[model samples]
Target: MENIQHRNINVNGINMHVAEIGEGPVVLFVHGFPELWYTWRHQMLFIASKGYRAIAPDLRGFGDTEAPPSPTSYTAFHIVGDLVCLLDSLGLDKVYLVGHDWGAIISWYLCLFRPDRIKALVNLSVVYNPRNPSVKPVDYMRHVYGDDFYICRFQEIGWEEEFAKVDTKKLLASFYFKRIPNPPLLSKDFAKMFNPPPYTIPSWYTQEDLDYCASKYRSTGFKGPFNYYRCFDLNWELCAAWTGSKIMVPVKFVVGDIDATYNFPTIKEYINRGGFKESVPYLEEVVVMEGVGHFINQEKPIEINNHIYDFITKF
Candidate 1:
């Protein structure tokens, strides 16, 4: 851990925080909601050991990075721009990219908008959703999944007050383990949902891990993370220019069979049938770890490290 270096670099008009290690072909990691670069610690160390430079950034609006006060600033363009700038600042021409959750979504956009900057991509948990020109993203989710869908709950932007009512560990617990309902209604008081008299965190996540994350969130707050959700509609609007675009970079996708994103009925057919390949023509493989969940990289770090090493090493 001590060998991993942490620093802030100016990118896309914000000071972005990055954690990096090793000295070989670069592997950039992007994280998702309610998470920081810390989420990639195990993968970073493992990938670094495998002769790759592993870099994970606390994407703008998360961790030590500067959070713009507006949701609009959290759009795909803004985040992607920050990343491209970060790469440029590091003198990296191209990198093997890996992302989870929101990071996966943003990486898809990065590939679409700037394929010239990526050598290959390994996206986990979330699959690419090619823009649907007819309807906005939030509207589409609302129609298909309903207004109470988790994304819809974040639309108006007051989740933080209710989020504050619970302990940071519990908030992390609810997010990391609690299963969302079939229609994905994120209860207003959802933070308390993880409670049971004798609570337990997965054995893989240690108390030190929880304490570290708790301390970071205590300083940064979750609004920065929530803002990513708030920009769904705006991203749809801004991304119209690339409505029919496809991700051309070499790709490998891994998901937990039980992950909510993979369980979406449309998604299963899309991934296995043809929609995913149609959207990402260069996608090379898809791996579903039998019993794993959304946080696959963290839950099964050794396996994920092997996955990243095996795939990226081929290029």
Candidate 2:
């Protein structure tokens, strides 16, 4: 965490907290769900040492960034708008992009909505899905996966009440793993499921890392973080204007073979059958890391940094 500079820059009507280092062409990192700008700590140092300015922001919520009360405010347009405005505020025109999890989703939108602002992108843990004019994304998930699906559960009101029962550290820690079940669902026995016996933190992710994130979440609560899910249908609706659009930015995608998103029944087939590259026409490569999980960046920092550098350097 040393040598990193933190500051708040007003963007998109919010004061966005950014963690930055080095001093060259910018590498703007976007963090994922339940994560902060601090999520990219390792990559910041590594990429900065490699001579590029490394910048990571907490997105619109989930860290020091101000969270709007309405979930409707967390749409793809809103999040992407904040990031774009951040670039403007910082006097940047275009920068290399890196994203993971929700950040990956937002990065996809960033490329789709404003490819002119990105030199190249390296996205982790999510594949680019072609815009389906017929299916509302969340509705499709509910139809196939049922209400027990975590996204469905998140859609229901008061899911955060359940989150409130548990400590934030334990909640985030349960998710750190090498592999997670495909189609992750919430069982009826909620307490037993989330509040099970304590376990040790994985060596790849330290107690300090967990503590840092937990401290942030403890202040903001999980409601704003879950707001990203709350806007799934809205993002789909708003993006109707962009139906059938392909991401124009050059991209390199990486995922863990065991990542839950990777294991989604049709995801692998789609990624392998040329559908992913079809949507992302400029996709430079796809790297499937063995035995990794949803938290790909933090769990495999060196390899992730190597992957990011390998592709971005080409630009």
Off by over 4 Å in 1: 179-183, 189-197
- Candidate 2: residue 53 lDDT (0-100): 97
Q: What is the lDDT of candidate 1?
A: 0.87
lDDT (C-alpha) at residue 18 in model 2: 91
The weakest ten consecutive residues by lDDT in model 2 span 174-183
Whole-model alpha-carbon lDDT for candidate 2: 0.87
Please, what is the TM-score per model?
0.96, 0.97
* Candidate 1 C-alpha lDDT tens digits along 242-273: 98899999999999987888887698899879
Cα error, residue 192 of model 1, in Å, equals 7.5
